[model samples]
Target: MSNVTLHISKNFKELLQFLKSISFSRAIRVGIAVTLPVLMGIQLGYFEIGLALSFGAFWSSPSDVSGSFRHKIKGILISATLVMIVSFIKGYLHFQLWLLLPVLGLLTFTIAYISIYGFRASLISFSGLMALVLSFANESEELEIYQYAVLIGVGGLWYLLLSKAWHRINPKAETEEFLSETFLLTSELIETRGKLVNPHEDHEKLQSKLLKLQSDLTTNHETLREILILSRRTSGWSNYQNKRLLIFVQLIEMLETAISNPVNYHRMDVLFNDHPQYIKRFQDLIFEMSYQLRMISEAGNDHRKLPKNDFMRQCFENVRRDVALLRETKYYEEYLMLQNLLEYQEKQFEKLKSIKRLLGDPNSTEINVIDRKKAKRFIAPQDYDPKLLLRNFSFRSTIFRHSVRLAVTVMIGYALGSIFAFQNPYSILLIVIVIMRPSYGLTRSRAKDRMIGTLIGGAIAFGVVFMIQDPYVYGIMGVISLVIALSLVQKNYKASATFITLSVVFIYAILSPDVLSLIKFRILDTLVGAGLSYAAMLWLWPAWEFVEMKESIEKSVKANKDFLHKIIEYYLLKGHIPTSYNIARKQAFLETSNLSSAFQRMTQEPKSKQREMNKVYELVVLNHNFLASLASLSTYIQHYDTTEASERFKTATEKIAFNLERVVQCLKDKTCNGAGASSEDTTLFDDQLPVFNYLEINTLKSNDTETLRELQEAHLVWEQLEWLFSISGRMLKLSASVKLD
Candidate 1:
């Protein structure tokens, strides 16, 4: 009983926390924009006009996500324009069913196809689709169809103005919130990583969590880059901007350090198997660091004074003490690896302290001005090239197939609804649009979530109608439900769906007398539409993740190779980090995350479709490890001074690059010749390079930190390159086994 109660309480607390998140805040803003017009229209005897305005506002709100103010304005305007245009066409064609069907198909194909541009464009396209669906709503004959379209356009502009006003009132709110969330997720990632130190923990489950967090962190970092870096480019830097930007950089660097810390959990376990206390100490310090980061995030969110991190300092002291104790153990060779991990933790600790200091003192001069040209390189520009659209208009294009599938499904849904003479035939089309996705797994998941949500929402609305008949109460609940629904749409689809049903039912209760009938119709329409969506996805040109896995894997391997090349270049140059290096690193992280995500989706697919599951899993694991090893290598070089690049190091990198190229070719050509490293390749350069023998190094009794640092750098670089070569060879073997060609 106590355990159950505790679990419930924990979930309740999490719910409360989510409600306080930035997503919820955005939802409230959108809800206000959507509902205010209707309420005003009711009071002024222009309820119909208000409803039209509200529709416009609601459609445009989807594109009002975080970014530069300029981007936000541009997205909102594009969405508004698309919504108005779509609404006008829908209105004029509604009375002509023969014409409306073909027009709807073409419009759906065109609008959905435009999503290939990118995320913001996808949201804008979604807005247009929503407008087309809602334009099916019966309108008062008092206003002409064109007049209603104009009012809807006015509503979108009204939302734009409100959104702008909100920004002016609190310009940094979104950026600050995003940064804090990033810190929090990073903290969670650290905590999960700490669990890997335990011998009994489920390593695979923990790895999955880490990958999921990485995917989410990638998204947050991209948005932050767009917000902070681009703003710096266009608006110039302020003291506040400088502080935030510095903290952002620290956050990213800290993530890299953390990711690289766990190069091989199996190795760590083996090294510390006898000295469990050392593992405990390291784990405790990591947990403490994660705790301090959470405190920093909380402080930033609440505008409170940044907390003192004396505990972190104490934790590091404990870890250092343990490291000293490890020196006396028989694991002398393993001590270096442990020491490197300790250094990584120390680097993370320093970064956290720096972030706290930067946040606490806005005037701090710790931030150096980044070059404008270099900074601009970090922001990835969206390609709106019309040529891309033309290129993708084929059966081979996933987006094209998806667009066609959706159009056919929607047209069929409309025809069925019309034949059955449903009270609200458009609801069927609406559900199809809301639930269908480009991928089979997502569409199936959405269909399931929608059905469950509609049922629960219907029950709740039914109970509410039975107990209360006050229109004012209905109005209040409607807005609250709308806000909650939109907020959770991206985070929790089932919860969002339930609230969506509630909001719709409540809004209808205000205008219609038969609340029960409306609930029944909503439920019926949802079931039919969701079923159709699931069927459409399963049978209509399905793009299975397994079928696409080879492409994803190839992209990831190629990205890692580029990243490795950049690191090698930096090692040879020992100069400023190039923009291309950063770009390559970003691509590596993104592609790896994409591959991980695709693998996850593939697992959710039908068992028969999951070809070579074991091989695919191994490949995913190897690919992730390769990136982690590369990160470890790069992190060490970036932080410490090293000797000039030698011929031996160049030779080793070439071998690794060759292995990676073979893997890529194997995926493309389904053949691998001479995949494994030859004995000559492994030892060809060993005779040419100086060996930093552990025993000899200690015999010198040298206290020169520079000499010690150089030795460590050489040893780590050589070992990392060897590890990369081994992993790439394994990847080549696995790629050959998968038989992608």
Candidate 2:
């Protein structure tokens, strides 16, 4: 009994921590969105009618996630248009149980499936879904179609106006906030990189944590990126300010490169096992960078001048000494890796210097937007067309499956209410529709939150309704509850549900004096809906991310191979980088990011389901570091552009590309054992790709010291190339070990 109580206490504390971490700004945004309409309705002496408008107004969620202010207003416009159209037609086609079931089903499926168009489109779909359900309200028909349409449209417009008003006063607010968040996430990434190099830490657990952090950091960066792209600057600021903003945007992309370009932790640990000094030096370097980033974050948050990181030259000197020492060692591979790390580390340092110069130097402030078009055109990873929606209308699409499941569940729930003649059928269907999600884990989570939230909220509503008899007091309570509900809905659903329940109780108290009856009905309806949702989730199209893991990993491996092939070909041909190379790079990053996501989801599943977690981590780590190595070599080319392709490099790169393809084939054939790879030793130019393709050292007769220097530099790059090829070979074995069956 004591142990159980202790466990419960621990869980409660964790829950408390989570609730405390909810964003205050988001809550405030919701508050404004909900309160403005209510106040307007009260002033016009149409309390109950205005309350209905609040539901539509809330559809915009005040457009807070990301997107330009204009885009947000456009969202409100589009959503209002959708609600207005649906409201106008709702009265004519009265919904009957049998007829409504099929119609609702189709609408839910169609709207949900079409969300793949983009984030804005997804919000519009959600608005359409909610509007249709609300339009079916009993009192809705009494109001003339145009009157109801105007109320909802006005409510939406009111929220949009409120949101934009705040944004207009401080256009850089979102950008600054997001930039701070980006740098903060970068700091976290640097710390994680430090952990990766620490030999004492459990690398598997570190990888798991890194995977989860990547998901969160990626989300934060995307939101920040969208806001910047959509937002515009007013003429109050000079060209320097505009240029500074552009540099901040560039820094964000640099941060992404840092986040994605982690070295192979296992290899690093092994390499530095006896050399704690080297690991310590890198850790110190990263922490200093992290500190510099935090200062940059501070500058973004407040207008305070960022403190200069004056240690860049000192760090460089230290690295130079370390490189000199490594060069003296017989192990050429380790020397090459450390050299690559130096170059990779240099990129981050350069970014810091750029940011510092942009922030601190008064002379730098005189810059102008040389090309307004180029300055404004900060295209994100992608921006697709809405017309491309049809391409995903297949059985293989996850969104399609999710749509079908949602339609079935909500329809069944609605059928229960309509067939049995329940008083509030819409309430019942709404709960099921909102609670059911695409993933099993999420569905279970939402159902639990919804049930707890409703019960707790219901109890609180019953107490508060009678305690506060004044209608005016209840009105204030309604606003407060709405703000709490809207804010927590996405972050902590149970908390949102509780407040939402409270808001509904108080809001309805204005119309109906019987508060207890409303509470009782709300609880009963929610319970039945929750029950239906739980059942549907269990019996519905069951899909677990881990169950789909094998395919995701395979795709990632193939994508990486293709990308590496392109990189190698670029080197061999010594030609201009083609569009295919860029395409391959993007696909590779996308798949790797996807694999990280899959691994993250796998961690949420039962441990038994994770067939080869360690192997998957190894593969992910290997590919990430290999990409970094490629980027390092790419940077070298940019600096030393005059160096022509070496014959030895051509042969080594050819063999490396060939073996990488072999790895892909091995994975495809489910023969990842790293076998035939060795046997290819049918020793031609070299027996089957040897672990290390030791090139015969040809003594150059060039007496010119400059020529020797050039050869020496080329030799180092070749060593880095050889090291990456070796990593690919190891990844082949790891991939083979993954249990596809």
Candidate 3:
């Protein structure tokens, strides 16, 4: 019972925080999108046309997710053009049912097909939406028909001006929020990673938590790179802000690597599960790291008196003592394991120390950089290259199939509306276009949410109409609804849809004075649209995520293989790791992350579709372990100069990469024969092992103490390589087991 109360309290607090986080900047931008245009339209005695103009403004809102000041400005221009083109086409073909029907069909198909490109998709989706609005306006004369387009263009342009104005006025606010959020998220990640080191921790539950953390981390990092890196590059910030930002960005990336220990906690548990003395101290060390992360955040303006790493420096003595004890007890393997973990802790401490020095003093000696690759900008704006998209386009694409299905659904909905001679013929048409997606599950989910939202929203709008006696009150309500809708559309689709429904209804009550009929038609149209969407999803190109799961696994294998090869190549080069090598590692980890995320989604799917669920889970776990082992090897490479490269170690790395490719081929070809080639454990680096009695203790332990220390360090790196090979062998076994049937 107490647990339940605490859970509720925690959730309620999060909810409150979420509400507080409502982007006032975004909400204000939304105000300009609808409120300004509506106010202007009302002043011109065009009160009835607010809905149409607001629709145009709403079309431009999706571009707000991630864009620089320049990118934002360019998006607005492109969006405005799209809206105008869509409006012009719809207006020119008004009331010519037979001719317009074919044109509408082609337009829907064209827009849906081109949605393979993300930015083009947004522009085309907005244009298609406005085209729906164009058909809704009651018109006769050519000029009157075109007037609707002009008003919507006014709204689009207004939104553009407002967005630019906000950035010009307060560029610092967004970047500051981004920086604070990144650090705050890092603090959360630190605690999470600390808890993960617990041996008794639930593996599945922790993985689930990790997935969520990773998703959030990815978003924050993208935000960091987009705002901090790009805005500074474009000369939109002060020199001080830019320099400080550059420093912080480096720290953040270091923190990212430090927290990303891919070593299995279970393995840690096995080593220290019986030794509470060792385990407890390790836990304390992690918690201390967590504490430092929070302190960094709390430092705020007082960088001069920020926390120190005296605790970590003191703790390393105990860690070293534990390693010494294990070394004497015929537990050389365990000592090596603990040493690697200590290496990680020490590295983490050094990063925080470096960060502290840079922050407090603003000038520090040449700091140690684990990653020597030069910082490169990762600018990922929406692509506008039609030629590139077309050149790589495949007519056999799933997106293409989805486009055909969407065109069919739209035509069917329009035909149904026309046959019934409905007053609002778009009741079915718009919903069909809006709800249909490439995936059956998504379309079904959207249909359910839209219908639920529309009903509740309509009920609220009806109550407002019954209570309010003034058109001005209705108008005010509409503006508030627009603000709420715009703020949440991307964040909470159902809630946004509800507000949108109420907002549209309120606008009609203010203008048309026929509340009952409007509500009646709106509800009926929504029902029809939702039903049409559902049917199309059931019968049309149904792309199940589970069906594509195998391909995703194959890609994961390929990525990991390439990653291993790159790391080996860097080792061969005996030079600083290149940018391309880092990129490969990033891609591999991301692919593994993607595969894990996909499996989570697949779990949410119907059980019948979740084939080989256990095998898939094992595969994901093995892949994670493989990557984590590689990450451990990365730490080994960091300290040592890649010299006197052993032929055995190089051969093992080569074999692992080759094995991964074979695993991928086996999955693709559905044949595992000769794929999981078992090799003898002859590549064992630990000569102390009873199974490998190749070297004498005297040779490993040199007469000169300093030389002995150097030999031990080399031996540790050898053990790390062997450990990685062991993990790779297991991955091959797991890959062989990954079967759809």
Per candidate, the number of residue pairs that clash is: 0, 5, 0
User: How accurate locally, in lDDT, is each candidate?
Assistant: 0.83, 0.67, 0.67
The TM-scores of all predictions, comma-separated, are 0.94, 0.81, 0.84
**RMSD after CA superposition, every candidate:** 2.6, 6.1, 4.7
Please give, for residues 1-741, the per-residue lDDT of candidate 1 as tens digits.
999999999899788778767688789889888778987998999988998888889889888888888888889999988998888877767446666677788889889998899888888988988888777876657778888888888989999999988877777877888998999999998898889878778988888888888888888898898888777332434767777888888998887887884346666777777677787888889998898888888777343657777777787888877775555653455666777888888788889888877777665565776565676687778998999999998988888888999898888888788889888989998999999988888988999999999999999999997899998899899989988998898888999999999999998998898998999899999999999999988888887887789999999999999999999999999888778987888889888888988998988888878889889988988998899898898788888777899887888788889888888888888555644544456576456456656743444344766755665676677667767776777787788778432
Winning model by TM-score: 1
Global fold similarity of model 3 (TM-score): 0.84
**Could you give the candidate ranking by TM-score, starting with the highest?**
1, 3, 2
lDDT of 3 by residue, 189-282 (tens): 6666667767777867776676566656656665556555555344333443544455565555454455445345555677777665786667
- Residue-level lDDT tens digits of model 2 in 1-741: 999999999899756544433245556766766676667777997765776577667765534555566777777788777776666655556666678788778877876775676677677767777776666564553567678777777777766776767666656656656666677777777777667777898876776666666656656655654565445655555554465566654565454446533235556677888677788777777778877787777565343567656675677778768765765664555665566567667777877777666666644546545344443333343346655667767756667777888788778877877788777778887787677766666777788888899889888888877577888888888878877787677768999999989898998898899777778778888888887776765566655675577677668777767876776677666667665765565566566677777776666655666667777667776766666566556555534443666565666676666666766766667645675464453244333233454222223343654553454456456555656667766766676666645
The better-scoring model by lDDT among 1 and 2 is: 1
After superposition of all CA atoms, the RMSD between model 3 and the true structure is: 4.7
